[model samples]
Target chain A: MSSTWLAEAFAVFGKDWRSEMRARHSVATLVLFALTTLIIASLALGPIGASPGERSEVVAALLWILLLFAAAAGLPRAFVHEEESRTAAALRLAARPSAVFAGKLLWVASLLAALEAIATPLAVALFDLEVASPLGLLAALAGGGLGLAAATTVLAAIVAQGRGATTLFAALAFPLLVPLAVLAVAATRSALLGGEAGPVLLQLLLYDGSIVVAGFLLFPVIWNP
Target chain B: MRATSLSFSGVSRRFGRVAVLRGAAGEVAAGGLLAVRGPNGSGKSTLLRCLAGLLAIERGEIRAREEGRELATADRRRRIGFLAPDLALYEELSVAENVELFARLRGVAPEPGLAIARRFALPAGRPWGALSSGMRQRLRWAWALLHAPRLLLLDEPFQNLDAEGEATARALLDEHLASGGLAVAASPVSLPLPRITGELDLAR
Candidate 1:
């Protein structure tokens, strides 16, 4: 990208970051949802009474699902807030659609990464899980976080334009994100079980790239329309 | 650089089965003002939006030119400043921050916007949501003039303003036209402009 485009994108990102800092709506919602879900899951499961192999699998699956649902609950606010506040038209006139998309994508990715940083260790401690490959775990989380951000950011923009936005976002996001979730679960499980996570990591990487490219390509149409 | 001018003819737009604007036409040369006068729900806002390239017209042509060269839609949009009741800045941001944000997005220095805000006597540190309605209208003017756009598309330019605020707005519009800038204002009452190049009266 050209320096001007990057500068404009960063301007948008900074604006969103500052706005979110003051409002704290999405952050509060995401944190509360994630924490509540984690608490409920831990209480209900109460230490997985299964084989070590099955325990890791269950923990991995549960962790990804929790993160995915939390993302669904909060990320749509990125664009929905703009529409609700009547700022979308001013933003549309001020910046290019691609720049706006990139900025929102960055904000969503940053939020997801931060959520993972906090929740991953918390989940590990709560579940009493051991990581066999820290590098593999990190890779899976990083790739998965970026892919999830890419998919949700564009979908949020699409959802903001229509009615029943919250319900629409969940309906649109879960089906699209299932593959990424599966890859993330498998990679996490492999990392936890000392298995080779190379193939799953590669697949996750491909998924990240494909979804990001698709998001960039599709966002302009969705944003302008 | 030659002065910019705008012309539109046979413009028509619809929302579902209802036609909002039908066969609306007008033109304004540089250093002139075109007043769009009409009653409520007369599609004055729709026509201004169409001229700003914000909404697509069903069947019509709108063109902006500078130096005898027709400007493309993107080029026109870049040089056009638009303001309406529905358009809003970030409420959480302070006045200075909002001005700076739009300046950076428009790729211009923030100094000009800051200066404009100061000229309007706006509190730089005040949050947008905390501002009164009149103050908000002044801030909108400051934003619209931030980039020194060639074409100004203003809808209800005098809304929610006291006499002093209205005078400030009038002075700004007068200054803009005197500097060879073009303007199209949609208002229910007559504008205080000294010279109106043309008027498109939309009937309800």
Candidate 2:
């Protein structure tokens, strides 16, 4: 990332993350949701004696589904700071739209990262599943969570200025997110089943890069007046 | 380039087969106040949106002088002050907070105008869009003016103003022009006050 890239990303993300810290809703809500989800997964997939591969598959899928919703839960106000206050218009007026996109991705990345930290450990503990390479789970999480944040934030901004923002957000996001869901689940399954992560991590990086480029091109088109 | 001016050359815009504006062209120069005259459905607002970069142009170019070079779209927007009828205000924030947000977004310093003293002060406590028209109008003007924009575009600026309100509105325009700026106002009819440099009859 260029220096301006980080600068702009931090500036935009700083606004929401600060509020989220003060509001405590993003962390508090996702953590509680993850906890309840873990309990449910624990009970439903009970006994820990099931075949490790089966446990790994189900755990991977369940873990992802929970994290996906947690990430989506925070998507509503993605670019809402700009929408709600005319600040968005000012943001357009003030800086390049590329800067705004970078900043927003940063915010969404951090939010998703926080949620990942909360969910990943609980996922392993609750499911009685083995983490093949602790490092693999870490890589899957750091890569996957940020990818989810970056992609979701762009979609959120697209919906932020619309008439039925939240409803439309989910609808627009679902189709675009199929690829991400596949990649995240695959990576996690590999992690839990003790497979090599180099390839999976490469896929995750490609996913992130594609989104970063797509977002860079499309955001200014959608974000501005 | 001049200090402030907006010109649309053969500017035409359409959505599918629905033409909002065509062959629409005009000029408003620095210290020149122009009023765009048109009735409903005449594309007055659409024209301003094009100037503000909120709407894209279809056929022609919009040129606003920028540091001795003619710039278009977002470049024009950076120097122009735009006030749309459908005002977008951040409601969750306080009055001063909203203003400060815009000011900071423009990378400018803060200026607090008394959050304590009650009457006739900046509308600090009220939620955005939750105030009287005059107050909302004041906030709109403040947001656009926060960056000391060179070109100001007002759409139906006097929409809900009464006799006294109209007087105040004209005074604000006069004050703005006194400082070597440009203003293009779109309205239904002419007001009695002075300082209009030109008129674009969009009704034709």
Candidate 3:
């Protein structure tokens, strides 16, 4: 990337971080949503200590579901807030579209990271979950977070222009995220059960890379309208 | 800064089945301000947005020139500063932070606004949301001129201001025109700027 591209993106990122720090609305909502779902799941599955295989399968699916819903609830704010407050026009006038996309991607990714940090530990503690391969689990989380942010940022822009954007964000993001969600669950299950994670991790990396590239290429057209 | 010019020919824009601007055209060379007048919903703001590249035209071309030289269409946005009612600052950010962000994003030095801030009685450390309407308008004006832009597109440039604020704004526009900058403004009444040399009456 060019220097101007990077500089402009970082400027956007800094602006977003400053704003989010003061508001603290979106991050709080995401973390609360994830934890609420995790608590509900834990209460429903009370005292049922199944075999390792059974536990990993159920826990993996539960974790991914919570993350999916949490992302849908919060990530759309990145674009929706801009359009609602009329800051989108100012940004369009100041920075290139690609730079805006990059900056938004960074902001969303950081949100995902913060959500995972708090949610993952809470899930493990509440559900009595165990990860046999810590390194593999970390890699999976990083890949999944990147994929989620990349896909959601662009999709958020798409729905931001329409009415009922919050409800529409989930409807639109679910289909686009099916592949990533599936691979993330598989990789998490493997790491939780001491299975080799190389193949699933590779697949997750490929899926994440593809979507990030696609989002970068397509966001300019999506943003202009 | 270099002198700038803007010209549009046979320009038209539509929203759904309704035409907002139809075959409307005008030009403002450097050192001139073109005041656009129209009734409510008469496409004055739409015309300004089309020139700003925030809205694309359906049936014509908008072009820019710098120092008497024509420029490419893609290069026009970077050379223009636009202020509109819908153009907003980050409410969560302090006044200085907003100015800094806009400057860095445009790859220009942040305009030092302590004097201007004092003139407007604006608090630099306050969040934008905390400011009154007049103060916010003044902030917007300060940033639009931040980069010493070659062309300025202002929609309702005097939306919410008192007599003193309007006087300050008129003087700023006067200095901008004196320095060979191009400006286009949308208003229902006459703008106080004395250098307005042409008018585009969209109400007709």
Candidate 4:
């Protein structure tokens, strides 16, 4: 990207971050939802009670599900709030469509990364997850978080234009995110089990890249239309 | 540098099964103003939005030109400043931050925006949500002119303004026109403009 484009995108990102800091909409929702879900999962599963094999398998799937649903709870607010407050038109006029997308993507990615930073360690401790490859786990979370953010950012823009936005966001996002969820769960499982996680990590990275490219390609139409 | 001009013809727009604007045509040369007069729900805002490239027309063409060269969509958007009732800045942000955000996005210096804010007597530290309606309207004017756009599209420009705010808006509009900036303003009532090059009555 050109320097001007990068500057514009960063401006957008900075604006969103500042606004979010004041509003605390996505952050509050994401943290509350993730924490509540984690508590319920810990209570239901009763920490480390499951066999070693089942612990990795169940915790891996549950962790991704928790993260995905928690992200959904908050991320849609990024675009939906703009429409609700009627600020989208001003933003649309002021910034390029791609820059807006990149900015929102950055904001969403940062939110997810923060969520992972908190939720992942808690999950590992709560579930007694055996992390055989710390690097592999980090890679999985980073790649998976980015992919989730990319998908949610564009989908949020699409959902913002229509009614029943929350329902619509979940309905659309779940189906599209299932593949990412599957890949994330597999990667986490492999990492926990000390298995070869390189292939799965690569797949997650490819998925993140694809979603980001597609988001850039499709956001203009979704944003402007 | 020659001034920019905007012209549109055979424009038609619809929402679902209902048509809003049909065959709407008007032109505003550089240093000219075009008033769009209509009743509520008469598609005055719709037409201005179409001209601003915020809304797409089902038929006809809207063209913006500079120095006799037709500008593309991106160029037109960049050169156009738009304000409407539904358009808003971030409520959580202070006036300075809002202006700075838009200035950066438009790739302009924030000093001009700050100057405009000062002219409007807006409190630099006041959050948008805390501002009164009149204050909000003044801030909107500051934002619209901050980028020094060549073309201005305003919908109901005088809606929430008190006499002082209205005068400020009128002065800004006049200054913009005097600088060879093209403007299209939509209002249900009579506009305060001193001179109108043409008018498009969308109610008809």
The candidate that wins on DockQ is 4
Error of 2 at B158 (Å): 3.5
- What are the per-residue Cα lDDT tens digits for candidate 2 across B1-204? 474677877778887799989888888777888888888888889888888887778889787874456776766766677776666655555577666555555555436222211222545767664777666666666666666677888888877656665665677677778887788888777655457888888889
lDDT of 3 at A136: 83
**lDDT (tens digit, per residue) of candidate 1 on B176-200:** 9898888999988877775589988
Model 2 Cα interface RMS deviation (Å): 5.5
Query: What lDDT does the true structure give each of the candidates?
Result: 0.86, 0.73, 0.84, 0.86
What are the clash counts of all predictions, listed in order?
Answer: 0, 6, 0, 0
Give TM per candidate. 0.96, 0.82, 0.95, 0.96
Cα distance off (Å), candidate 4, residue B152: 0.8
lDDT of candidate 2 at residue A205, scale 0 to 100 = 89
Clashes counted in candidate 2 amount to 6
Tens digits of per-residue lDDT, candidate 3, A39-149, equal: 888888767767657867888888888788887877888999999998988888888889999999999999898888888888778778788988888888899989988
Q: Tell me the tens digit of each residue's lDDT in model 2 across A90-148.
A: 56655567877887788778777777777777777766677887878788887788788
Proportion of native contacts found in each model?
Answer: 0.49, 0.26, 0.62, 0.62
Candidate 3 overall lDDT versus native:
0.84
Regions of candidate 3 where Cα sits further than 4 Å from its true position? A1-3, B1-3, B72-74, B113-115
RMSD of each: 2.0, 4.2, 2.2, 1.9
B86-178, model 4: which lDDT tens digit per residue?
Answer: 778999999999998888888888998889889889999999999998889889989999988878999888878888888878888888889
Candidate order (TM-score) = 4, 1, 3, 2
